[model samples]
Target: MDKQAALHHFKEHHFTPLLESELDKLEAKFHRCQAGLISDFKQSFRDLCAYILSMQQQGLKEPIGYIHYSFLRTQMLEQSYLYMVEAYSAEWYEDDSDCKLTYDASWAYAPMSAMLENLEQQRKIYMGAINSADVERLILESAPFFHSFVDSLVRLAIAESVQSPEYQAIHKAERLLIRTGEYRDISENLYVWDQEPLRADEVFEQLMQSSEEEPYVYENLKSLSLPHLHQFQKDLRYNDFSYSDLRGSQFHTCILLGTRWQQANVEGGSFQGCLLSDTDFRYCHLKGVNFSEASGRVDRENGLRTPGLCGIRFEHANLDEADFTNVHSFEHAYFEGASMQGTRVPRIYQQHWKLSDSQRESIVWTE
Candidate 1:
């Protein structure tokens, strides 16, 4: 097909429209997740406290003042109505704070997990049955908020006498709580609110970082929605950029090796002089982009090896003026549709290439 005909076909058949549609759905779910998640956490914390207090009433020392969700999955988190909790494990360890407790994926709650799953659907799962969302990193950054919430709740339970349903406020104006209303023993999860309501929007912002500033050193930027982001010579290697909407973003000489760009919209972006060895770009948009001097391959010398691109698929992508002279994988890279026009690849690729007649006609050999 001619260039115009092929481009028209690609535009009509591209799957980007489906991905963009999902963004709206995810945003709505995110708002729901924030408020509901916090409330559920408060209830879980209060339930744990009541369980400890019951043991103390029976002349047994409270094992631990922990709202440990992983442990509670066998107890209050077990879909109980009266805080009749049990234990997942008979052990507790020291938390990040002075509290003798443990921590798992705080986002392991049902609402937050659904939000994360839909956000990065193609993520690979290694540790568990489910694909782990940048959960570890999210928990790390929001450590202050979690620790404060835990410590304050523990202090309230320890100081106050667990006798009846009525809560005696130390400071009425500063106390923030959510009551279970099911049991008098399980009254509330207390915290010093400082007269401010929980900022749900602020919590959600951690996942969808804005383009105004650079990301953290180890931040997981998978399924990002920031567009027109501008940067220079950044080290963003070994990150997941799959399903990202980074269209028109500029990266002058950035290191993006082993980065995933599957189905990411990077149209009109600039990646001049970038190191993209072992980078996956199959099914990504690259319409009218500048990628000059980008090394997709490297030479191994004195037994020192460097990562190189092996197979790439420009699946109906617009590869306008992309020069792959030094790209060793240029021979193995697949190109179809509009990507066929004027793509400059090494002459060596043509001599030793194993592509059939139809595939060979799509490529242009260069010195």
Candidate 2:
């Protein structure tokens, strides 16, 4: 087509609105991609934290565990980019539209790859300077640098002045959406430190304060882990984890005498070999929570029974050899998969228990 003929067609079809509309669509898609990238990155970080916690639980602490993690953030960010923006970039460029315009929208995201690479290099440099054997500290300190990635990843690959005012405005809004509380600032929540992390005592105080403000502190108690606390310390005894979300939290083998876990979501957590004497776990969610070898207020040898687990509902909970000797009213507590061999209960509500033959065989009910 001749230039004159093409110009005429463009003017006749009112191509200006069509172009603007397509640009708006591109902007909207960018936001979706941007949000997805942040989401994926955050989820991956959480999984990493969970994995590290699991290792710590096994009494495995190695210095330079930091070396392994130093390589993750940048790789994870690149993966996020591929999923969020790169996959659709080429598709959008080749799109057949009424305006017959071909847009390499991906060009606006090209600078991000270089930026991520630079970040990785810089991270390696920072990681090298650390002389400490503390793996947690190494990981924690390296984390704040990546917080900027959440803000910078969504920036346009083009020069700001070259962009149209509308494109700039759209980009601004998308960036602001994440910077605001809705997406959550990583430093404020995930890293949760200014220069250094809070001490165990400080974390406890912070959690207790947060508990009072919120109805139930759901899933935000990730910082409550106390690796430094020893079994002999008993420092966190009588801690108030009641009415909080403790799903998947680990308190295995800790001395938690008289701690209140009432109504807390303690599902999938471990209390193996824990001293849970007089702990108020009434109505708490204990599904999949490991209580193997846990002891309560009752000590049949010492005659220290104090009506433990009175009115407690352990329906369907497998108490594998959990010492409930003389626990008052726990005769009514659920003991579905428990091997009650040698474990004694009142047997008062034994008739009301609904158990499979396997379950019944498992529970060696003693009066």
Stretches of candidate 2 exceeding 4 Å from the true structure: 1-201, 204-235, 297-367
Total clashes for model 2: 0
State the lDDT of candidate 2 residue by residue for 1-367, as single tens digits.
5545544443334333333343344334444575455454444434433443444346342211110111123333343322111101112224222111111213223433443343344434333442222222323333332322332332211111113343222211101111111111221111111123335577655444442223222122222344322222133443545455666666655665545554566656667666665454645666555555555543322211222322233433434344433433233234444334433334543575655576556554656
Question: Candidate 1 on 1-367: residue-level lDDT in tens?
Answer: 5544533343333222323333334333433463454455445545545544554456453333323222232222332212222221123232222222232323422332333344344323222322232433332222222222222223223212222232231212232232211222323332122234323344235423422245322223546676887766666664556567889988777777656566788888877777776565766787657776676664333211234312344555666555565553444355544454555656777765455565456556777
Error of 2 at 101 (Å): 84
Q: What is the lDDT of residue 150 in candidate 2?
A: 32
Error of 2 at 308 (Å): 4.6
Q: What C-alpha lDDT, on a 0 to 100 scale, does residue 131 get in candidate 1?
A: 26
Once model 2 is optimally superposed onto the true structure by TM-score, how far is the C-alpha of residue 344 displaced, in angstroms? 16
Question: Best by lDDT, which number?
Answer: 1
lDDT of each: 0.44, 0.37
